[model samples]
Target: MESYIQISKINDFIFCPRSVYLHTIYDNFHKKSYQRTPQIAGTIAHESIDTGAYSSRKRYLMGKEVYSDELSLCGKIDIYDLQTKTLIERKRKVVKIYDGYKYQLYAQMACMREMGFEIETLKIHSLSDNKSYILDMPNEEEWQKFIDIVERVNNFSVAEAKILADSKKCAQCIYQPLCHPL
Candidate 1:
């Protein structure tokens, strides 16, 4: 069986295809004992959002639990609302830096779509300032484009070149040494 996919990994692929390959394909994550402020803050934010004390009828799937065989995609959504039957993907302030979030969100959207869900809405909740932004799904042409992107990711060859771009943020990653060599 293929390993479960994380919706966030889809975004990683979009941000840098090579990064996704390294993280997912090679299973190259290293253990980091140090807890960074951002991760700590994100945990706090997630706690506020995840407790489900605010909303009635809360249902959630995380980590390996969220999956889709048809789309051949899977990922942990921070929170899923069973009441409205929508996917509420949470992001800290940091996600604003990446272009891959769209792909990640779209992958979730695509999976939900495939699961016969009448997704009433797709909201990217920003925990930074406590705000939610609705992502408008594209029209026919754009939908096709997104599908093509998904197909491309699904069919990506092992021979594709891997490039690791330097980022200060890599310091926070346990996989930093493997991804960016000295």
Candidate 2:
């Protein structure tokens, strides 16, 4: 059976498939999560977005939830400028454009387009830097890349996943403590 992927999780999935599995464990159990300052800050930064309080203008779909039946993916988009045909994905900070970020944006655009939204412009807005990176829409091949990720995630299982214990990537992960257990 295929997994019902979340557009927001495309970033986490690329960052580490195992982390996604661990995160699901937390969510399923409703465990108390110990978050660092950055994690709390990021959540605080998204308060408005989570509540859909972005713009008063009708041209923008602020904090709107979109679903893609084809991909079995769903997520709330930060901002969709209907007038400009732009979809903006906001982050707490962004010093560099990573593949994880790009894939998340691509997944969002693909799902939106499938839902009949005009999405010609792709963008990522960094709150810390107050800068936006405008990107071109993903092509068919790019969309296929995201599709491949979805398939991998569907096949991924906690028992079958490998834990990269000594990877430097773990240092940057919020779930490192739970994942590594000191």
Write candidate 2's Cα lDDT for 1-182 as tens digits: 75477776777778888778777777665333656678879888888877766556788788778877787888888888988999888899999988888878777776788888878888999999899998766678977887898777666777755677667778888778778754
What's the lDDT of the predicted structure labeled candidate 1?
A: 0.61
Alpha-carbon runs more than 4 Å astray in model 1? 1-5, 25-64, 94-99, 164-175
User: In candidate 1, what residue range of length 10 has the lowest lDDT sum?
Assistant: 27-36
What are the clashing pairs of model 1? 5-74, 6-75, 7-75
RMSD from true fold, candidate 1 = 4.1
Backbone N/Cα/C clashes per model: 3, 0
lDDT, residue 70, model 1: 69
lDDT of 2 at 53: 69
